[model samples]
Target: MSWKTFPKVELHLHHEGAAPPAFIRGLAKEKSVNISGVFAEDGSYVFTDFVHFLSVYEAATQVLKTPEDYHRLTLAVLEQSAANGVVYSETFLSPDFCGNRDLSAWREFLHAIREAADQAERDMGITLRGIVTCVRHFGPDKAKQTARCAAETAGDWITGFGMGGDEGQGRQGDFAYAFDMAREAGLRLTTHAGEWGGPQSVHDALDDLRVERIGHGVRAIEDPALIERLVAENIVLEVCPGSNVALGLYPDVASHPIARLRDAGVKVTVSTDDPPFFHSTMTQEYEQLEQAFGWDEEDFAALNRSAIDAAFCTEDTRARIIKRLESQ
Candidate 1:
């Protein structure tokens, strides 16, 4: 009955966004940065809307000033994720945050993060892979630099490229050059879409960005044709039900589109988009799905299988995790 003990895989987590508020607060205090307004007395992030949440997310990252800081952060995040039974995860890592879009500077942070992840794999039962991500609102030009950073190290640790942030950005096509660069480097692609924009945005991401998976593509349910297209294409959706409720994208867990998307023959996987910010853990995500939709262990296992299939990791790694999942 304790979902916390169930093996799980996360595919759409954000690196800095997963930072514990206490972790950020500690870093802020060490540097004398006054960001107390970002958190409530309960030590939870506060934001009235999505745009404000984006600003708050960036403000919190200012505390992570060095690669060592990211090393510490990676350990902390992995510990929390492991405790919640996340056996494997692929997190979104923005080069913009690592080094402000500088390839040389980003390398240092990537090294630190990868080192920490390796250590965590040894210490905890969690395995992590990084996806070099571009912040969409930062514009297409900046995305090109992020793609460069991803392409430079697209082999093992950094296996994927993605875009996150404001979904209302110009258009997915505007970032074609960056996606092309990552594609040429053989990086698997994904993009944040349909969470904020309508189904048309999801369509643009498919036609233009040509992503294999989508982050928060729940809104695609709005267009039946789009839904059918998604089913036909067999694109996976990284659905974060808890995040949807927390961000007011849905009124409650029961109203989330995850079940509908699944029943419609769409491949879907669950993740905590920003765990701490939404006051959710992987255990809580599983519990809510069970409570809201009467899901059972088999349901969760199937979801994990879908995540493993859609994961931007090596076949060897995926097979290893699938073996562990079967043991559960």
Candidate 2:
């Protein structure tokens, strides 16, 4: 069955990473910026590996320099998500990219993005929320600045704080202070773990950072004890199977641990971490999972229910999204 119109709740999209290659190319040409190295002859992003992907990702983001640029980006991203039936989505926004962790500048960028999001909601009936994120590779000091930006803007719109970027950079504990600051400001927390780092990384994120959810916590399958703990603690995993396979973490979707993790009673939700970068969409992810694991509409509906439960949005927003999901 085609999953194109199936309502989905996404919780782990990266704002900059979601930029479509064609959009980036257009922006680059308009700004006279050269980012031809990041794209292939077919106009899709090209990267040798995860680390190289980061470089290419950053190179592509170089053309997005102003609040207006982010405004356009937010609209373009939401249009893609809406097309694929993503009813509600929470996107990771890095102050490092927005305004170099400057509070005032970040606020300006946030305003533009929020304005676009509001417009999208009214026009397309797709809700968008922001999660302020710190780039792990940028180090702990910069993370504190990003966290401060998050704290200053802690509200209904900016609901959560997370850490993204290379999980191999530093231990999750190294950024405890930043996480603590965000927590103090009443922000929900989540961080990248178990994707590049081992199962131990998931433990560190839980024991140290105290996050309620984990981004790409697929490696937990390698440790039975960790899987049990995740279930016991009810920590949601934002599993991006396509992103994992695209980065060569797994050979294909059939080899991905999402099905195993779900069968083991772990709360797993689907997301397109960087859809364009991974050449994936919400509908495409559903199709792949269905083909690989024989997941039917009921399975996907359950996944969507789990996703809305784990989403960082307010109760009112959650209820509205749930209503839409049920109506569909």
Candidate 3:
């Protein structure tokens, strides 16, 4: 049972970040955008660190100025993900990128992306759902607008709300107003924490934002009480092992706390946070986990089941996906 054949679910992916370098390059060529430094001569996103990665990410996004651009991006990303054995994925979509904080433009962008997602599900057998995310580094006032857009568009395809960006920018409580708005809209919640902020950031996200999931929560392992609380509450951590390693969050995959956190009874699921940027896919993620932690087929299956259970989808859709997993 090779990892490439394993049925996997991803819960912490960014829509723009998942765009393959070649896809971004093609989009740039079509739009005649001068995003030359976005990719290297070898065709990979070039960045020095997380800060520069965000800059390159935004530079590549400049080519995606129209709704059609996002549609093409969705198709390209999902096609690649399907080829890598991703059966289900929930990707972060930002209004800042799509609409520039204008509700009208956001609606148009969302429509195009959702249409492409529907087609991807039909053609690629990969179910795609969106998590409307507010860019934290963009400031709290702007995040409120992004949250408003997400709250207004709580549909079957757009199932969740999240915050992404520089975790070190401000306190999580600063974004409480936006999270409250999403909560009122009945959207499932998650937030980026513990990547750069450590255990206290994870605590703030849990206590203030009240998210059902935490993105890149590997740092919670440092706080024994926080780990206990997470396990008791059944909050899932959308752990991206390869991304952490690539970003220098951990020195190596062997030093990652994913196995330790799972052993502590904290619900954990695997994901490729930014596939192309991190130079990983679902197949590579599972393969690396197997090599590092001695995980087997049953372990992978259990991880998939945990992801499905934690997924924010309709019961009918969940049942359908569960059946597909069982059949596999």
Candidate 4:
């Protein structure tokens, strides 16, 4: 049951959302900022509902105001992930929080993060790629700026662009231009859908944004036709069962649809969306899947294979990760 040594790939983590509560609290204390309401006395993020969760999540980011802070955060998060057997991960990075949507400043912050990632890979043996993301409720105009920042940095490190926020905000179609901009700049696309919105949200992401992947697309299980389309198109769902259950999308992992989606031939991959917020780690995710559905090492390997294939990383990096997974 100790899944910590099992090699894994994660494709849907949030940068700021992944910050450990103690890290943020330290920053807050250093800056003389009193944000006691954001955390429980036990040192975990505290929120009662999804909307409040987003609010608390954003509040925690307030303490991460500079590139150095993010650098330190990158190191801490990567160390934790490495401890959980993540060999490679693609995290959702938002320029909105990195530098308030400023391209020049975003680059500075990115440099710090990449440097930290380089060190983490050397020390912890975990590689990281970023997916520059736009906050949905922040609206389309700001999304354009976020897209521009992503476009300017689309390369080996920042390999993709996506959206994450309240899916109930403006229609996915409203953000097509932003996604288009990122796509034209050679960034693979994805977005948060079917987490708050229904099956139609997943359809809209495919139809409007033309994303190759869906963040939390498990809700598509509600529409068998949409599920078929996902399987037929081979679109990957960045399923975060822990996050979903923590946010009440499902009451518990036992009731989550990841197993159903996999059985239905959907190319589903596992990830801890915002691990600290959900009180999970890659090891815990695997353990829960095993307990809930009788999954084992072979099942995890297949999931990792699906995630690597769907990942936005280069073929060379993919090959290296595959080699590691095989050797494990």
Candidate 5:
């Protein structure tokens, strides 16, 4: 069977990062934002390295100046994801982008996004959930505010809290207060680790933040004890093979440690962390994994189940997703 024909689940996507280049270009035209260099002649985002990638990301975000922009982005992104055979996804949303750390504006953005999400579920049969994430590189004070917004807006759609940014910025412990606040509000937690940093970063994220999942945790392969602990604790790794390869984390797809980590008894799920930035989609991720590791239908199905199990959605939603996976 073609990998594109396999139904899948994505648990490590980012809201703004998923915006298509055409969409951002149209928005730029509307707002008269000077972001031409950010895209290529064929209308795709262009960046050389991780730091420049962040700049391009923020440049694309400049056009998303209102709640309605985000609402439209949510619908557009989901439509594309559904076309790529993704049946369930959880995307990271930043309060800093939604409202610049204002709770009221954040609520408005959340409402718009949730409304679009409900419509997407009805029209495309795709389940969408939000994980309120703090930009770790922005500073701990901002993260606390982001956590406060997430804590205040705890509901069916906003189900989780996370940290995403330059992992090398501040120590993981510096953000413990924010995670604690979100935990108090009963939000499931995760953090980006082991992507740009080494195994010690993963250790700090687990020991300090106490996350239930690790985003791009392929680096944990460096520490046998850490891999054993992840298996023992049953923590899920939202592995994004395409992102790792694009960012030089791995020299090539053949060298990726995803299959090895799974072989070591660690639970793993696949996702496209930033689809357009990495020139990847859900279908592409599955296809590359198949080509590199000879992943078959059963492997894809089990990966879907792992995503559903690690998802931060409500139990009822999870049950429905599991039922869909079984039917697939």
Candidate 6:
């Protein structure tokens, strides 16, 4: 009944956010960066709410000042994910954090991350892909620069573009120009919506940015019509129940709407968004879902199929991930 070895696919994860506290502490010590405010005495990340979590998250990222940091980070994250049964993972990477939107510098960071990804794939059997992301709180103009970075890097490794950060800062439509650039460059699109911003945020993301998937679209469960639309359009949701609970979107896993959304025929996939921050793993997510919704291995298998179908990887990579899921 253990889910630790079950093959899984993750569609939503933040690269810097996935760094383990111990790793961050070690990196901070090595760099002599004063990021003590970001962690508790026990060494876990300490934040009171979502906005505060963002601040703490950014604080932790201070130690990751170069491409080499990201390279090591990619390996650390992938090793943890692989141990937790994640076979395929798509991580959100921000050019702002990588190189302050400088194209050449972003490429260097991308290359370093990709090298680590290749190593992880070879050693850990976990396929890693990047989704270049624009921080919504950084505003639309900055988003344009981030999009330009994404457009330039659209390829087999960096296959998707998305918006993450404070969804409450601006409407999804505000970043239309940025999303358009990424779309025209052949990068698939997704955006954070409906977690704190509510059902209308999901509506705006679909009607404006036209993303194929939504990060934390659980609030769509509040509106029957939205749920119906998601089903009709086959829009996928990258649901992170543990993250939601950790951030007080829901009191606990049982109160989360992922089950309700899935039962409504919505294409829902599970992920541990900033796993260590949420004190979760792919295994923990499965265990919580199984306990809350009574989801069995069959349910999880179907979820993996849906995730693979919605993944932004190339068809060959998708097929390979599907095989891994089936082999279980």
lDDT of 3 by residue, 94-122 (tens): 99999797999999999999899999999
TM-scores, all candidates, are 0.99, 0.99, 0.99, 0.99, 0.99, 0.99
RMSD of each: 0.7, 0.6, 0.8, 0.7, 0.8, 0.6
Candidate 4 collision pairs: none
Badly placed stretches (over 4 Å) of model 6 are none
Best by lDDT: 2
Residue 159 in model 4: lDDT: 96
- In order, the Cα lDDT scores of the candidates are 0.94, 0.96, 0.92, 0.94, 0.92, 0.95
How high a TM-score does candidate 6 get? 0.99
Off by over 4 Å in 5: none
lDDT tens digits, residues 136-200, model 5?
Answer: 89999999999999999998888999999988798999999999999999999999998888889
Better of 1 and 2 by lDDT: 2
Quote the lDDT for 145 in model 6: 100
In terms of lDDT, the poorest run of 10 residues in model 4 is 34-43
The TM-score measured for candidate 5 stands at: 0.99
Query: Residue-wise lDDT of candidate 2 within 88-152, one digit each (tens)?
Result: 99999999999999999999999999999999999998999999999999999999999999999
lDDT of 4: 0.94
State the TM-score for model 2: 0.99
Clashing pairs in model 6?
A: none
